[model samples]
Target chain A: MFNAIVSADTLRATLDSVSVLVDECKIHLTDEGIEIRAVDPANVGMVDLRLDATAFESYETDGGIIGVNLSRLEEFAGMADAGQLIQLELDEETRKLHVQIDGLEGTLALIDPDSIRQEPDLPDLDLPARVVLEGKDIDRAVTAADMVSDHIALGVETDEEAFYVDAEGDTDDVHFELGRDDLIDLVAGDAHSLFSLDYLKDMNKAIPKDAEIEMELGEEFPVKMHFDIAEGDGTVTYMLAPRIQSD
Target chain B: MFNAIVSADTLRATLDSVSVLVDECKIHLTDEGIEIRAVDPANVGMVDLRLDATAFESYETDGGIIGVNLSRLEEFAGMADAGQLIQLELDEETRKLHVQIDGLEGTLALIDPDSIRQEPDLPDLDLPARVVLEGKDIDRAVTAADMVSDHIALGVETDEEAFYVDAEGDTDDVHFELGRDDLIDLVAGDAHSLFSLDYLKDMNKAIPKDAEIEMELGEEFPVKMHFDIAEGDGTVTYMLAPRIQSD
Candidate 1:
C-alpha cells in the first residue's frame, strides 16, 4: 500500500519527462522515494527519473511497483493549477489508484507490472566531455537546428573551449556555439556526436528554461543529459543513441 | 504611387478582422482614410472596416484602389514586434507592393482590383434593441454556449432588463445572463434571434477583451456588432444573418 500528497507541478513534471520515452512506466514506491525507469519502444532512447520522499508533503509506502499509463496520469494532473496539492492512494486489493485534486476524484485501473516489457539495464559509458548551461540555450539551439536538418551535431571544441550545435540541410545550414564564459561549467574535452532532433525536441519540452542541465558527450557515441526538478528534490536523466555520420 | 507607415498592431488588427470574412479584399485609399468592405462567399456575413489617416504614422495617396491577399499580409505583419512600424509602398508601374519591417523586406504582387469580387452594399436595418458591453463578456458567453449546442439564442428580456444567451444540447444546456447593471448600456426591447455558433466563434477572434462593443438586435433579424480598433482611429462592423429556430 502507498499514499502520497504532492504538488501538481511536481507530478506534472515527472509525467512529462517519462511520457517522452514511453507511454507506460513502472513506478516503484519505497519508504525513501519514488523511482521510475523506462526506454522507448524503438530502444533508441531511455529516461531515468527519481523523486525523493522529501519532495512530497506526505509520503507513505510499504514497498511496491505499479504500472500506469503516463498519458492518462498527465491529463489528470493538468486539471490542477500550479502549487495545488494532489492526493494519490493506491489500492492493492482492487489494483486501482485513487487520485484526488481539489474536489475532483478519479479511480484509474492499474496495469499489471508483469505485462510490461522488462526494463533494460543502462550501459555505463565513459564519455569524454561534460558541459553545463541553462536549459533555454540548448532549447534555442535545437529549435534553430531543426529548421535546417533532421539531425543535429553536438561537439565540444577543445581548442576554443566551447560547445557547438550544427545542422546542415540541402540548402541551409545552422550553427550555434556557447563558450566557457557563457556556460556554467565545461570540461573542454574532444567529443562530438550526431543525434536525431525529434528525440531531443520531445525531451526538451520537460526541461525548464531556468534550470541548469549537465550533458555528457563522446565521439560517435550516445549523449547523456541530466537536470534537477521538483526544486532539486528530484532528478531526471535522458540518454539517446547517436546516428552514424556519413563521410 | 502611394506610401504609408503604420504600427504593426494596427495593421494586424485590420487584417484579422477583414480576413475573417474574405481571403482577398479591395482596399480603397483616399486623401481622407482607408476603407475595406467584403462579404463571405456564402453571403451570410459581411465585414466593413475603416481606418482614418490619424491611425498611420504617415499617409499619402492620390485616390486609388489595390487588391491584396489578407492572409499573406497578416503573415508578414506577424513577424514584426508589437508597436514596430511597417512601411508599405505601392509601385503602380509594376503593380507590386513593397513591404519593409525592421531589416526584412518583401515584394508582394498585387491582384487586379477589377478581377476581384465587387463589394456589397450593407443593408440598413432598423433594429429595436441595442446593447453595449465588454468584448470579453460576450466572448465568454459564446464559448460556454458552444460547449453544448451548434446554435445559440440571444435575446433581451424587457421585464428583467437583461441580455441572455441560451443553448440546449441533447443532454446538456447552458444559459448566461447579464443584467442592465452589468453592461455598459442596454436598451431593453422586444428582440430575439438564433445564430450559428460557427460564425460567432470566428468573429470573436478579433475582438479585444477591453474594447466596448455595441450590438443591435431585432426579432428574427440579423445582428450587427461594431467596435473600435486602432485606438479609436478605426472601426469594424460585422453583420451575421439569423438562423430560424425550429420550434
Candidate 2:
C-alpha cells in the first residue's frame, strides 16, 4: 500500500504546462530523485525533466515504478477543484493510481504504471554554454518562431554580444535578439546549434512565462533547459537532443 | 489605406479567448458592426461576444469585409510585449493585414480576407434557464470531463441543487458536482442535455474562469453560452446546435 499527498494544483500546473514533447512517459521515482519523460507528437515536440524528490510531501516506495499517459494525469489534475488537496492511491492489481480531492467527490484513473517504458540510459552530455533567462523571454522567442517556421536556428556569439534565434519560411521570416540586460547570465563560446520547434514548445509548456529558466547550449548538441517552477518548491530540468539539419 | 492602433495584449487576449469555437474565419466589418458564425463541436457549450463601435478608437469601414485567421493574430498577441501598441495595416490586393508591435519589431501575415467565411445566422431563442458561474468553476468542470470522456452531460436542476456533469467511459465513470456555494449562481431547467467534449473545451478556452459565464440549457436543444469578455468591453455569445443521442 503506497500513499502520497501533494498539492494537486502544483503538480497539475507543472505537468499541464510542460509534458508537451517527449512521449517516453517515464518519471523516475526514487527515495531522493524523481524524473519524467514524454514525447510530443512529431509536430508537437519533446521534453526531458529531472525533479528532486524533496518537492514531494511524502515519497515512499519499496522500489519504483514508471507511469504511462502523464498527459491523462495532467488532464485529471487540471480538472481538480482549486485549493483542493489531491490524494493519490496506487492500486497494485489494477496498476492504476486513484486520484481524489479533499472536498470534491470523484475518482480519476491514472494511466497504468506498467504501460510506460523506462529508459535506463539517457546520455549525459557536457554542455559547453549556459545562460539564464526569464520565462517570458523564452516564451516570446518561441512565439516569434511561430511566425517564421517550425524549426529554429540558435546561435551564441560573444563577438555579436547577444543570443539569437532565426527562422525563415515561405510566408515570413523572424529574428529574435536577447541582449545582456534581458539575459540573467550567458556563458558561451563561438558555438551555434539548431533544434526542432516542436520540442521547444513542449518544453516551454512545463513552466510559467515569468519563471526563470537556465539554459545550456552546445554546437550541434541537445539543449538543456532548467525550469525553476516555483521559488523554494523544486526544479524541472529538460534536455532535448538536437535535430540534425540536412543541407 | 486603413490603419488602426490597439493594445496588443488586450486584443490578443480577447480574440484568442473568444474565437475558440468560431470557424467562419470571415469576421464581418460593416459600419462598426461585427458578426461571425461558427458551430461549437459540443452541444452543451456557448460563447457570447460583442464589440461595439464605441469600443474601437476608430470606426471607418461602412462595407462588410472579411477577416481571416484572427486566431493566428491572437497567438501573436499572447507573446506581444505588455503595453505594446499593436499597429494594423490592411492591403486590399493581398488581402493581408500587416501586424507590427513597436518594441518586438516584427511583421505578421494575417489570414487573407477573401478566404474567411461569412458569418452564419443564429436566430434568437428564449432561454429560460440562465445562471452566472465563476470562470474557475466552469474551467474545472471542463477539465474534469477531459479526464473521463470526450462528452459531458450538463444539467441544472435548481439553485438548491448542485450543478452536475456526468461522464462514463470503459476505464472509469465520473461525476462532478458543484454546489451553490461553489457556484456564483444557478438556475433550473425541466431537462438536461449532452454535448461533445471538444466543443466545450474550445469554448472554455475562449473565456477566463474568473469571468462570468451565462449558460442556458433546454431539453434536447442547443446550449447557449454568453461571455462578458474584456469586462464588458466586448461581448461574445455562442449557441451550439445539439447532437441528439441515439439512446
Candidate 3:
C-alpha cells in the first residue's frame, strides 16, 4: 500500500527514535507522510514521530497502517552506508516489506497490526521551562552522569539563568551547566525533575550529535524532548516519566 | 630508576602486542631500549617486542628488569588521546609506576619480577616462503574467515605465484587470494599451514592496518608475523602454533 525511498541516515534515525521505547510499532502511512507512536511496556516513556513525504526522495501511498519489528528494520537499514538510498515497498499480498539498498535486496515479514499494543494518546502538560541546545551537549552530560549515579536531576536555575544536569554517586558527583550564552535558546521558568538514566541513555544513543534538541520541563513532571531530522522535514518527540525524589 | 615518555599510540601498540599472549610480563629496560618476550599460558603462542630509545619523546634508564600487569598499564595509557605524550616513571622504593597523561595522573603498583613467568627463547625456524603485504589486507582476510570457521589455512602456491587464506565452515567457505602483483613482495615456494583463528584474530588486532607485515610460512609449522611500530623505531613479532588437520 506504500512505497518510499529514503537515505540510510534518515531511515536509521527514524527507526532508532522509536526502537528505544518499544520493539514493535505501528506505522501509519498517509498521503502526506508516515506517523508512528509507541509507549514502553512499563509505560515509563513514549515516542511520537512524523516523517513527511518531503523527507523521502519518492513517496506514494494508499494510506494503511502496518506493524513492524523496529530492531529487524534497524539491522537492515544499518547495512546501507551514509547517503545511500534505501527503497522500501510494501508487499501487501505476502504481508512483507521488500527492501533494496545498493545491491542487497531482502523481504522482511511484517507483524499483524492487531497483535501490537494500541498507540497511547499524548498527554498534555504545562511544562514551563524550555531549553534548546546541541544534542552532543546533552549526550555528553548524560554520559558523565551515568558514570556516577543511576538517576539524574535536570533543572533550570532561574536566578542564574542557566540549565544544569546533575548526578550524585556514593562518593562522587558530576555536574554540567550551560548558560544563556552557551545554549541555542532558552525560556526560563521554575522547572526541575529527576529521571532514571537507564531510559535516557538508550534514548540519547538515537539522537544525532549535532542536531539541536528542544527540551520542556516542569516541577517533578515528565520531560519532553524534541528534535528535527530529514533536514527538518521530520520531527521526533520523546516523553519520559520522572522518578520522584524520595527524600 | 627508569623514566620514559612515549605517545599514547606507541604505548598502546607495545602493550597490546604482548598482552594478547600473557597478562603479566617482565620488561627489560636497557640503556638502548625496552624488550619484552612472553608466551601464552597455554604455550600455543608467543610475542617478541623491541622498542628503541628513539621511539620515545624522552628516555632514561638504570638498566633493570621490572614486571608489570599489561592490562593495568593499558588502562592508564588509554586515558591519553592519539599522539598525546604519556610520561612513565618508576618508583624503585615503592615498586610502582607513576603515569601521567594530560591532566590525569595515577600510580600503578608493579608485580614482583620473580612472580612472573620467565621469557621464552625465540625458536629458530627455516621457512621456505616469505611474503610482505599490508597488515590491512591480511586482517581483512582473517576477519572474513573468522565469520565462517574457527580455523584457517594459509599457504603460498608456487605455480600460481600467489598467497591465499582459506577457511571452511559447516556450510560456508571464504577464500582470499593475493597474487604477486597485489602484494608488496612474494617469494614463491612450497609452504602451507593450518592455524587456529582464535589466536590469529587477537594478534591481528595489535597490528596497525597500514603497516607492512612480513610473514614467513612453512608446511605444518608456526607463522612469524613481523611489523614495525613507532615509525620503524619498534618491532613486534607474533608466533602462533599450527593446528593439525586430521583430514
Candidate 4:
C-alpha cells in the first residue's frame, strides 16, 4: 500500500517522462522511493525513471509493485494545476489508484501485472563519450532539425570545439552548433551517432526546460540521455537506438 | 492602396473576434478606421468589428473595401509574439495582403468582393435589457453550460439583484448567478432568451479576459454582445439569433 501528497508538477513530470515511451508499466514503491523502467514497443528505446520520497509532500508506503496505465494517469493529471497538492492512494484490494485534486476524487483501474511484459534488466555497459548540457539547448536543436528532416546526426566533430547536430532533408538541411561557451559543460570525445528525430522529438517533449541533460554516446550505437526533474528529486533516462548512418 | 503598422495583438484580436462567425469578410478601411460587418454561414449570427486609428501604431488609408480571409490571417498571426509590430500592406495591383511578422512575409490572396455574399444592414432596433459585466464572467457562464448542454437560457431573476444563466441537460442542470456586486452595471428588464451555447462559447474564446462585455437582450429577439479590445481602441459586437423555447 502507498499514500502520498505530491506537487502536481512533480507527479506530472514523472508520469509524462515515462508515458512518452510506454503506455503502461509496473511502478515499484519501496522505502527508498518509486522506480519505473520500461522499453518502447519496437524495442528501439528504453526509459528508466526514479523518484525519491523527497519529491512528494508526504509519502508512506510498504514496498510493492503497482501496475499503472500512464496515459490514464496523464489524463486525470491534466485536471491539476502546477504546484497544487495532489493526493494519491493505492488500494491493493481493488488494485486501483485514487487520485484527489481540488476536492475532486477520481479512480483509475490498474492493469494486471501478469498481463504486461517483464521489466527489462538494465545492463551495466560502459560508454566512453559523455557530454552534459541543459535540456533546452538540445530541445532547440531537435526543433530546428524538425524543420528540415526526419532524423538528426549528433556527434563530436574531430576539429571542432563544440557538440554538433545536423539534419539533411530532401531539399534543404540544417546544422546547429553549440560551443562550450553556449553549453553548461562540454567534454570533447570521439563519439558519433545518427538517431531518428521521430523518437528524439517525442522524448524531448516531456523534459522540463531547465533540466540538465547528460548524453552518453558511441559511434553508430545507441544514445543514452539522462535528465533530473522534480528539482533534482527524481531522474529520467532515455536510451534510443541509433539509425545506420547514410551518406 | 492601404498600409498600416498595427500591434500583433490588435491584429490578432481583430481577426479572431470576427472569424468566429465568418471565415471571409469585407473590411472597409476608411478615414475613421477599419470596419467589418458580416453574417455567419447559416445566417443565424452576425459580427460587427471596428478598430479606430488609435488601435494602430501608425494609420493611413484611402477609404476602400479589402476582402480578407481571416483564417489565413490567424495562421500568420500565430507566428507573432505579443506586442510585436506587424506590418500590413495591401497590394492593389496584385490583390494581395502582405503581412510581415518577425522578418517573415506571407501574402494572402484577396477574394473578389463581388464573389462573396453581400453585407447585411445592421438593424437599429432598441434592446430593453442591458447587462454590463466583465467578459470573463459571461465567458465562465458559457463554459459551464457547454459541459451540460449546447444551449443556455440567459435572463434576470425577478426578485434577486443578479443576472442568471441557466442550462438544463437530460439528467442535470446548472445555474450561475452573478449579483450586482459582481457585475459592472446591471439594468434588468423583463427579458430572457435561449441561445445556443455553441455560438457563445466559440465567440467568447477570442475575447480578452478583462474586457467589459455588454449584453443587450429583449424578449424573443436576437442578443447583442459588445466588448472593447486593445484598451478600448477597438469595439466588437456579436448578434446571435435566439433559439426558440421548447417545452
Best by DockQ: 2
For chain B alone, what TM-score does every candidate structure achieve against the true structure?
0.98, 0.82, 0.97, 0.96
Residue ranges of candidate 4 with Cα displaced over 4 Å: B1-247
Docking class of 1: incorrect
Q: Residue B17 lDDT in model 2?
A: 50
Question: On residues B154-189, what C-alpha lDDT tens digit does candidate 3 reach at each position?
Answer: 999999999999999999999999999999999977
- Candidate with more favorable, higher DockQ: 2 or 4: 2
Candidate 2 lDDT over B85-151, as tens digits, reads 7766666677667766765544555565566443456668776566678777677777776667787
What TM-score would every model get versus the actual structure?
A: 0.55, 0.53, 0.55, 0.55
| TM-score of decoy 2 | 0.53
Worst 10 residues of 2 chain B by lDDT: B39-48
- Tens digits of per-residue lDDT for model 4 on B1-247? 7899999888988998988888899999998899999988888888888999889988889879988878988888888899698989999899999888878998989988877777877677698778888877776677656655789888876568678887776533456777788889888786789998888887888767888889888887888989998789989988888999999
Please, what are the lDDT tens digits per residue for candidate 2 over residues A33-138?
A: 4666554443223455544556556656644664656566665666555665666666767766666663334454555556654343445778777788888888
Chain A alone, TM-score per model:
0.98, 0.84, 0.97, 0.95
**Ranking of all predicted structures according to lDDT, beginning with the best and ending with the worst:** 3, 1, 4, 2
Q: Which candidate would rank higher by lDDT, 1 or 4?
A: 1
Q: Which tens-of-lDDT digit does each residue in A1-247 have in candidate 3? A: 8999999989998999999889999999999999999999988889999999999999999999999999999999999999799999999899999999989997999999999998988798889999999998877778767655899889999999898887766534556778899899999999889999999998898888999999999899999999998999999999999998977
Task: Locate the minimum summed-lDDT window of 10 residues in model 2 chain A.
Answer: A38-47
* Residue B117, candidate 4: C-alpha displacement in angstroms: 25
